[model samples]
Target: MPWFPEFSSAAELARREIRIAGQADPVAQYFTALNEGRTDALEVVWPGEVVIHDPRAGVVRGHRELRTFVQDNRSWLAEHEARIEIMASTVVGPRAVVELLAHVRYDGREVPWPMAVVAESPDDRSVVFRTYCSQWPVDGRRHVRPPVFEPGHAEPGDVVGRHLGALASGDTESILKTFVPDGYVAEPIGPDYIHRGADELRSFYTGTFSEGGGIGLQNCTMIDDGVRCALEYNLIAWGTHAVPPQAGIAVYERSPDGLLAAVRIYDDVEPPDSR
Candidate 1:
């Protein structure tokens, strides 16, 4: 059962509390298959090749690999006692991005891990899922993420455009102006890295631009519903150091007054200076 917008109306989707309520969303079904350790449902739904690019398991292709991957992740999920909370979702053309905030036991206590899963259907015959998140919450280490999508030409507008533009030029002050006085920038790791207000954001951006350049991100797919914008991109560089192209997704929340309310990143790209 797929709950695609093409089958349902936008008004109806807005009425639902959670998008994964039924056996609809393919991404939801993927998690269900992993949690329950089953693969028959996935085959029945797509009946074609299913590819998954996970942070830990790497690339899983076909049902054979998916079965093994599901079993392994199920055991890990049970051990961690992950309580997944549904967040917002964005749908554009063949791509559907669903954000999940899961609270899992880590280092002796529960930590909220923000993750996003992208489901792209090239046709009715296949589906590609690429998940984005910082592994720091789970293992306290950042892994270098490989690029998932090639560079795209989706240039966002408004404050998101300003933020990205400022970052591309390494203009710390201009980037800072894109946010409201009390806006916050949250790192992908966890809530522990959220930088709020002007002073804290200033401090964070100052260090961010200390490399003599801003964070280099290549624009990709972006879905902006006027209120919240979800951008999937490949991180290309970190200041002066050229990094391997890596994939990441960011959700930008806009304030009512046209400034950014919050910016949340989900990626494993570690800084060059990180020690």
Candidate 2:
């Protein structure tokens, strides 16, 4: 016999609606929960297996730690009178990268702190955030941080991987070989410091090698799409000075020929023991 399907009760329907709303854009919900200091809402969007790798708080897993991290972060922002201004956002596949400027009133002066967050959702039930930023803007000094990820080697087929290998080798020709003829590299600090083309890149790489023959990268996490790769690394050593390791993030966009077309970096790491 033909039969009618059972319908959900009003209360059940309401709960389903809430779940659908929460899943609309989990990342947006994440930021909203942080800004509002709403741990309940955060728990709704963050699965039990959620993880956060933060510079200040280190790595936090599970719901309890995440709740504490969120609350503490909110308190810290409030204490510093900090406001986040979103500069840009780019999403590729299941990964999203957001660039923002943290405006904080410190020492009776307002400072713009550059920051970036990479959000990755492996499935509907899991997500992770890797935040990158310089600590100088907040405390007026560099705060050393422990490694967030484990030491790992890059895949051989990746162009950015080859570039990192060249940097570590301190081979100028090898480094340049990974870049296109008209490629450009943007430093962490100023906008006017961009090095473009072969001659300019040669000079920039030379200077970098002069300061530190090779950079020791630790705890690296790379997010690579077909055309671009976003890398987060800890600069453990540079040159002769074995200074405290600092965090840095860089985005490398590749040309059609598989060479690096542009490299953009974000960090506050100065030369070894510049302080």
Candidate 3:
């Protein structure tokens, strides 16, 4: 069995103890098919509700709309079977958050994405509504968060200095260990995009560091408003295969543990002018 990480909260731990009961029942089978693309099974859960947030296509709501959404991609899901595994689950109050590993296979190729589902029900027995999900990556640099780190925990300048120090040493882990799980990051590059979670975030760093160039930060500043702190810094990219380092401004939101829950990067590092 693949090792699924556990949670520190006892409430979360208790939820994990619930026996999945037995082998997947008909209802479970229906959900599996619905997720895997056999829209035929969707009717089983229909009359209830369904909403899909497609990163590329945007948000889709209702079973009829969902059916249209799925039918529109029948050729896609039909090509493969996607497996969804629950990695970690926690139930608090009437809400249960489940972290999942969704393995997607298409034309014999597989891509795994991590997703979070927040299910809320009047009773703790069955799920009525669920929202939120994303493709998974190994690093956490891709996500950013709103500035929410409480002040007094650490000076913004100190936080900025620490980030720069991490870059100077190429200590990727320490740098990322500073952010919260739902953290956000806004990239500076033209295809401007927002990244959330640690896995995709790591990919951002891997790409930056793998460029065979030494990177550094400058002109860093920090600002906090009770809930989170934003660490703003300039990124210098230059080295072998060295193009001039584009100067970037980064903002980070810190968690209670001092990890970042959000980050934003803005800059213009255009290629050197060629005569």
Please report the candidate that would top TM-score against the real structure: 1
The residue-by-residue lDDT of candidate 1 on 1-275, one tens digit each, is 56676567765564342333322477787788877888766766666778999989889999888888989988888999987887878776667778898899977899899999988878765788889999988888888888877888888998999999998888978988999999999889887899999899989988888888888898788877788889989999888889988889999989999999999889988887752
Per-residue alpha-carbon lDDT of candidate 2 for residues 141-225, written as tens digits (9 for 90 to 100)? 6666555666655443577878888887677778888899999997654345689998999998887878646777773666666
TM-score of every model versus the real structure: 0.86, 0.74, 0.35
Q: What TM-score does candidate 3 reach? A: 0.35
lDDT of each: 0.84, 0.73, 0.46
**Sort order, lDDT high to low:** 1, 2, 3
lDDT score of residue 92 within candidate 2:
69
Residues 1-275, candidate 3: write the lDDT tens digits. 33334334554454334213211132343345455555544444343555543433456666666666666555454555656676544444444444455566744556655544443434323333333332223222233221111222323444545765665665666667666777766654312366677887777665655545346444433334434343333344432343432323344545677666665444334322330
Model 2 steric clash pairs = 212-239
- Output the TM-score of candidate 2: 0.74
Candidate 2 residue 230 C-alpha distance from true site, Å: 1.7
Q: What is the alpha-carbon lDDT of model 1 when measured against the actual structure?
A: 0.84
Candidate 1: count of backbone clashes, pairs at least 3 residues apart or interchain:
0
Against the hidden true structure, what lDDT does model 3 obtain?
0.46
